[model samples]
Target: MRKRARQESAFLNIPYDRRYESLYLAFIASLCAFGLRPRATIEIPSTKRRLERIIELIQGCRYSFHDLSRVQLDRNSPTTPRFNMPFELGLAVDWALGANPEHGWFVFESRAHRPEKSLSDLNGTDPHVHDGTAHGVLRGLTNALTRKIHDPNLAELDSIYRDLSKAARKIKESRDGSLFEARPFQDLAVLARQLAEERISSLRS
Candidate 1:
């Protein structure tokens, strides 16, 4: 008589430092739904190992879903501090999916083959436009998808864009929206310099 866990609540209730609560919860549900009643009760660490191996394979480009072992649903372990496999595998997946440089296994389909463009393209008449719509869109999409899907490498961008988009949307919905002139080039220049000097120097190694 095991009651089903609410997906969103289960997702949020996992420990803060533990990253892959999203994936683990989903995996547990999937296992239970498949009738593995006895297996789903196991601790996160055991299941985490399998996910880690799969991510490693993905990172090395040598793995597929078929390569992993099926986790039993009814297996329960009394392990505490829960496994961080989901978070770790998520990082590997993020690495596999690329970060600042586009070299990940999972690439976005949105800009697969399109030529990069500037903001002026949308408003050719604006001689002082700094067209950064492309960068903005790409940044937003990458952040949202990666964070929501548990891809770790690109997770920071989520809060960055969440704040950026919130401001942008608020401005857009205002009566003086037309006063929002594009300064994309200036923003890009600042971003480039910030990335090269300030940000790059701060990386973990």
Candidate 2:
């Protein structure tokens, strides 16, 4: 039973394309943002190095549009604040996921209890225009890959994920919010991998 559980958990960490109507929309949106025409499927490498490369490319492109340096945490707030760049990128991811829930390409859990941030919260004194930009970037990147794979359904899933992430960010930013407890997706991936390794080791022991 433990082994099965561990296998399931590990499987979650392995990224795969999803199947949903919104996913296709996300592909189109992403292509538009990246200035690329839609293809049958976005090509992505199956190796870890390739995955990291894709993520890095997205992260690099994401920082070009948003200025995260001035992101301010509410004073007297206990929860650690999300920097602007990461925050914006996160929002993009949620929106992309939300846009298409049917696509199976996105593997992250969009429905989990999230940090309680909403669009209103993030739209503080300054205009949160970059929220859309970040969203666009995510769409663009997802499209770039999905087009190669011939899956258009992931677009909507990416949209939804971005929307949920925004909500989660607002919740996490709040004093009573559990944002601080939230781990970076990369960190969570690492932890999950380690947990799986440990679980496997225990069986052998």
Candidate 3:
């Protein structure tokens, strides 16, 4: 089994397209606020096989957040539906059940029971719905994690979001209005970690 501290890291599986950018940011910020390090495939370099990299991340992290909000048909390709999120969720679930039953996972969808249409196997499981909005993501994430982690209260979560928004705006200004690039994403993660540490310290003091 992995060390307890190492298990605090959370692997995030969500859509990578621009449409989910805000929800992505909210997820990152919410995880940091709960004092968890957020890990994603984005941090991996292009030199490695993507599947291998994702598996490596899942193995390293003790918890995972899987969002199946975009499993519908593609706008340009109506007949084809995206399955990356569900595919990753399956991987994580298998690893947790087989390797470490203690591993944790939270599934999020834009609509309740929608995942059942695409993945009937998950019929009875309740996925937190986020309504495809950033605030909804924040709320759902907070509720999902609070039971497992030492999470902040709802008001504190709101404060963390406010701080994240300010930090993101600063990063965007510094980057000449280009904020989602690799460097900016790294900076945002660093800022979130720092903010989380500060909050914890304040609570302790």
Candidate 4:
């Protein structure tokens, strides 16, 4: 059962900040639209051995999506840039390259040419450019994944995303209005899976 779930899971590697909330929810909805469960490190406790836990999460998922849209420096006092997303992406790369050949990985960016300039390591690879919008994320996902039996329509995907956004907002409101927290994130994922199932079901009917 666990192995089956893992086969259906996708390690969601996106920034969990306020600025990326819409795109965050968009990713959850898009991945779920094609029947892939989205998992993240948020489920892990903020204790020791977090890095190892992240690697474990990546290993459990058959697919991994890395979003490098938060490319600018954060608004902290030190104003340092974030490396966690890219670092985990590296781990996913290592998993696909050396550890598990079945593990699939993808990169996403807001700007069309940013990943090539910012992360030259992915020179030959092309990151799905979302143009920093929820609609773009849906289109990007359509380009990224496909299901032979249940290929999702872009219009239906957008509908799912819109519905998920509404549910996510309510879930966050009940949880101190924080969209990126552990509990709310889990709720959001559950709701997204449900909503995607419904939307896709109607597509077949």
Using lDDT as the measure, which candidate wins?
4
RMSD of each: 22.7, 17.4, 2.6, 1.9
Full-model lDDT for every candidate: 0.28, 0.32, 0.79, 0.87
Cα lDDT for residue 201, model 4? Answer: 76
On the 0 to 100 scale, the lDDT of residue 46 in model 3 is 79
- For 1-205, candidate 4 gives per-residue lDDT tens digits of 8789888899999998787899998998888778887889888887748988998899999999999988788888899888998999999999899968988899999999888878999999989999989988999999988767568889988888899888887787788878887788788878887887777874334
Off by over 4 Å in 4: 202-205
Clashing pairs in 4: none
TM-score of candidate 2 to 2 decimals: 0.23
Which regions of candidate 2 are displaced past 4 Å? 1-132, 147-150, 153-158, 170-205
Q: Pick the candidate with the highest TM-score.
A: 4
Worst 10 residues of 3 by lDDT: 196-205
In candidate 1, how many clashes are counted? 16
For candidate 3, report its TM-score: 0.87
On residues 76-140, what C-alpha lDDT tens digit does candidate 3 reach at each position?
94577778888999999998889878778888999987877878888887898989988888888
> What TM-score fits each model?
0.20, 0.23, 0.87, 0.94
Higher-ranked by TM-score: 1 or 4:
4
Q: Report the lDDT of model 4 for residue 17.
A: 78
